[model samples]
Target: MKEKYLSTRRTYRESVRPHDGEVRFQVAVEQTDLLIVAQEDLRHEIASFVFQVRGEIKNWILFHPEFAESLSPVIVDDGAPEIIRAMAQAAALCDVGPMAAVAGAVAQAVGDFFSPRTPNILVENGGDTYLHSTRERVVALLAEPDSGAVVGLGIEAEAFPVAVCASSATIGHSLSLGAGDLVAVRAQDARLADAAATALCNMLRSEADIASVLERAQILAEFGVEGVFAQYNKKIAAWGNVELVALN
Candidate 1:
């Protein structure tokens, strides 16, 4: 799955966010749309940084068009932009295309860019998120748009500076070879979480694939994947540090 929150990005953003009093805002540049929560309103700073980083990525893609179009991992030079290198590394680790990690990588980049200015920050691109905070936050899970969100992951404050990303074959614009409802992955690296979510979602062709997909998530634990939540039809599976909770 590539993009899960395109049509309902705003609604989804509002639902998942904690009511902490932090300033919330949005910035959009072409295909990159971000919902950000920070201790202070840094819309202007974030927008300029996002524009610069996107331009760097675009320029590199122009020189190497295959990097953007490949369905498999591609190597990047030592001098590649930080985002490009992160995507390439994530794709290699998850055995998928670099684009699979684009959303999360961008979110992470933006979050890191302003980390020094704010003690708390959350950057969400589509359904991929990068979070850092001094307090716990709950992120709602929306396996199916029609059902809204019945559950959420309760992340402790200690898990700050983490990434949570989702992918769905049945939900959005992202291409998925599987038939799963949703797959969410958590990790220290947003790029890895994003790519891993996509890779794992591709393994779920039916409800029967849920168990094996969860097993696959366990194997990924060694690679810094903190947790995973998967759903296919009536079956659902979770592994690692995933903390499921009811969402009102």
Candidate 2:
């Protein structure tokens, strides 16, 4: 149910079945650790499919083995949106090497579980998250050292159910080249949020660029995320509705 990948932060995913319903929920969590509800058989099947997809993508990245690969040469194996998103996030984090893709892979794998089924699945891996419904807001904890126990902003809402992921150097177990306590990426693509979180974290240097990073996070949200929140010094900047503000 919980796993730490390649010497990085601890990643957790689980399939929970409601005792009274014919539905099972599989959740992939990072800081937020959010989940959605769906039919049991459907949800369980998606979770299993994504796990296998994660294994394949990790293997694919091994062949390319370069930071540039993260930006391009995207692995096109057919699986699910979540799986693809995770692979892309990993490719972007290639600068950190192959291990960078682990979180994204798991997150994406979890998200992909909702392929055709809409409005009942949600997955948040390290902050980058994706949801099928927006009835509720997803708030997540940002692993920031100075942004208080809950990063800059605890939870945010967006246009739809969404993807929000975070990266940190001084917090959590994940490795980062930057000093930011938290780098939040809120987007529709769980993988992009994963990559952006790493990318943004790498850019975190001081309070000066915090504004710019926030702007970038906001810009990312416009693409589909709806909201992107980045916090480093207790100054929190968020874009979009911040769909889920309770995951934290």
lDDT of each: 0.86, 0.52
Write candidate 2's Cα lDDT for 129-227 as tens digits.
Answer: 555553444344544333324322233333444556777666667666777666666655565566667767766766576777766666554444445
Candidate 1 on 98-135: residue-level lDDT in tens? 98999998899998879988979999888888998888
Which parts of model 1 have CA positions greater than 4 angstroms off? 1-10, 16-20
The clash count of every prediction, one per candidate, is 1, 40
TM-score of each: 0.94, 0.62
Clash list (residue pairs), candidate 1: 2-174
lDDT (0-100) at residue 181 of candidate 1? 87
* Stretches of model 2 off by over 4 angstroms after superposition: 1-47, 67-102, 115-118, 144-158, 218-225, 243-248
Q: Measure candidate 1: CA RMSD.
A: 2.3
